[model samples]
Target: MGQLRDRLMRRWTTARWTRRLGAGAAIALMVLSIQPGLGNVTHAKGATVNLVMWQQWGGGHEKKTLDKYIGLFNKSHPGIHVSEVAVTDNTKIVSAISGGKPPDLMDLGTTGTLGQWAHDGLLQPLDTYIHSSHINMGAFVPAGWHAVQYNGHYYGVPFMNFNVGLVYNKKLFRAAHITHPPRTLQELDTDAARLTVIKHGRIVRLGFVPDYPASNLEVFAWLFGGDWFKNNGRTSTAALSANIRALQWEQSFYQKYGRSSVKRFVAGFGQYLTAADGFESGKVAMMLDGEWNIAFVKENVKRFQIGAAPFPAPAGMTSRNGTSYIDTNPQVIPTGSPHAAQAFEFIKWETTNPALAAEYATLVVNLPQLKHVPQTSLFKDPNFRVFENEANGPNAHQLPQTAISSQFATNLGNAEEAAILGKSSARSALQNLQKMTQQEIASTH
Candidate 1:
């Protein structure tokens, strides 16, 4: 799915729905240059595996960590050399595969890209080598593995996982003289009101931004006894209507405080976590963000008393408790890499090693992906355990890992922006979006 992902990146990042899903069989193809010299290393001296891995974070620390992995790979397997390069965008991976110089392995955070690449013939299947080595994939969560499969064929190996939580400002709550965090839905609303502040006819402090990132709608819907798509627990389109819940939630906030006031208050805010970041500046009381923010906020904000809790439903609402969401960072071996054997070895050693996982997780503030990484006293922060347990729990689902995931997320985000802005009625907005989504999915098949 080289070009497919390129188009997806364009759509997903811009929140545009794709217009075409064309499949023409028996297209012109360039055969792989079968370099027996490259694949055959039995008698070769120090055969090197050149690798390029892409991830969202691209600072020097992440670079050093990857360098460490290559260092270890080279140290143990002197005969099998490894070279590492880091990427900021997965689009580069697209270029490499289509250009026929694809990296030996890719770490795309889950099965979606792996499945797409494999379906597009960019990825080579790993089942043969996996069975031969008897690799125990049980250590990784089910969602990543499920994402890696396409019609029973596994194309990638998973690396890590993470979950979301309701992070709040504790100092502000205490300043408001509220002693305890909300337990029930009603109590949360009451606490929110007390925590919020208005200045000069503008909301300087917002209780919560229910529609932030739009992905929260899915988690909230799941928590509030709403299903975006559920057929006997097999499928989901939950994000679409989370916009409805968001609209209702936002509309309620608007009713309590006029829409004009809410708009002006929101408009004055800066980006999510930067200097103008509402949470970082204490302008927003509560938000739904992922596990990495635990370390990030601790490092960035010095004076704020930060705490986290599972989001709650309104008073007397009967829905599942602690029903949260997971945003995983999974790794996969691409389908058409020239160095498949070396790639598998690298992933097997890295993923299976508890020590390295703990180290990386520390830097990123996510739970160790390994089954054996212990939660020691040093790592025993309250919300840290919450994220870890949720990641490995029954509710942990690697977000919809479909080949069409980019489209779904974009459409859902669009629906969310529209709903929050009151550009269209909530029901009509979703109905149009779902109809469009169905059309897009059908075009693909």
Candidate 2:
């Protein structure tokens, strides 16, 4: 899952390039589609159209799997030749598109910037091609379909997706006298407290690290019935009451252990995907992670049994019990590509083909973007089944699709960090974020 890891790494740099793009270059490109000589490029009759494609997965099984598929695509579609290159740095993508020379196709890892990219005319809409190709939009998971759309237009295709859940060490739970994973938020807190182990006035084994390894405050916000945006992703609602409650809940974990103590503990944690990783090393008992973690544990961890369950919702929120944050690896054709038609041809074949979609998802351990893909042996993995159910659940959702989505996520992360580290109250952090993001959105228009 190198591509998945690459997507995760985007969190560190999103606020930089994405922020600048959202504020500056993106604004300049907002009217690019209306410019003459910028229309979609089509191929001549029976002529081969060559396309350059870029993606984040640099090497390993993930890249090889994609290469295999691209090979298959090239072989099948003789009229279109799609060549892929591993380009992990997003700034290069921005530069290429802004300079009017962009790859025909690209997989941007996540939908975090889909809205901004589409709104700024960096990506060409696929609605016409989709309609002409008879692509069944209903074949996708609802959240996956939603993630690829901005302003009622389809700008990208979600090929691989996953939703997060609670993963716990069964051995640790049994030792703590817990028979089952928590099914409600209250039980989660109690179990975390019970499973935590302290020694020499330091945390040696933590019950849970709310922000460890990834950003999950958004998941908590979903569970608490809050969202960062509403009214079809046009307005900022960063300080929604439910969102504030979720932040408070996340901050409580840091408050339970002193901020300095928690910070030091997290600082000492090993790099993710390594043997010394906190969860893999048994230094952390519980975590909120995507379905890919199931395969990671199966391949990497041998010391204990790992269990996965739906992330708990607040008490009495039965309707929200199975909620998970739906995330995707979305592919798009940049505007002004010389081979937009051929690029769509290849993307359609890669994403909509049942056999290929199933194979790709299995190779990467991702949920197939299509809903009715034929099940393979991968479905038999119990932990994966838990996430599969969560992905199909009604409450599963992606982040709001807005032109400022990338910046919104960056601001939200900052707010969560401030609140969790005790630099400011949750309400104050969120309220301030609300005003700033609202202003950013307004300026974009």
Local error of candidate 1 at 178, Å?
2.5
User: Which of the numbered candidates is closest to the native, going by highest lDDT?
Assistant: 2
TM-score of each: 0.79, 0.85
The alpha-carbon deviation from the true structure for residue 198 of candidate 1, after best TM-score superposition, in angstroms, is: 1.8
Clash total of candidate 1: 8
Candidate 1 C-alpha lDDT tens digits along 1-445: 3433553454354322221111112222644332211212222333544444444454445556667776887788765666555554555566555544466666665444554566577677778867787777776656656656765777766566666777888888888998866766667777878888878766778777666523466676566666555442224454454546644665565567666676677777776555467777888887777766666676567766778776665566634445676644555665445557777887778777777777777776766655677556526878777666666555554444455566666777777567666777667767777677667656656
Estimate, for each residue in 1-445, the C-alpha lDDT of model 2 and write its tens digit.
4423443454346564665455465458455432212211323435676677888753266788988999988888887777777876666677567645577889888888889888888889988988998988888776777888988998888888977889999999999999999989899999999999999998888899999877788888888999877777668788999989999999999999888898898888787755578888888899988776665666576766889988889899978886788878888889757667778888888888888788877777889998888888878888888888888778787776788877888888899999998999999999999999989988988
Candidate 1, run of 10 with poorest lDDT = 17-26
* The best candidate in terms of TM-score: 2
**Candidate 2 stretches greater than 4 Å from native:** 1-49, 302-304
Candidate 1 to truth, TM: 0.79
Clashing pairs in 2: none
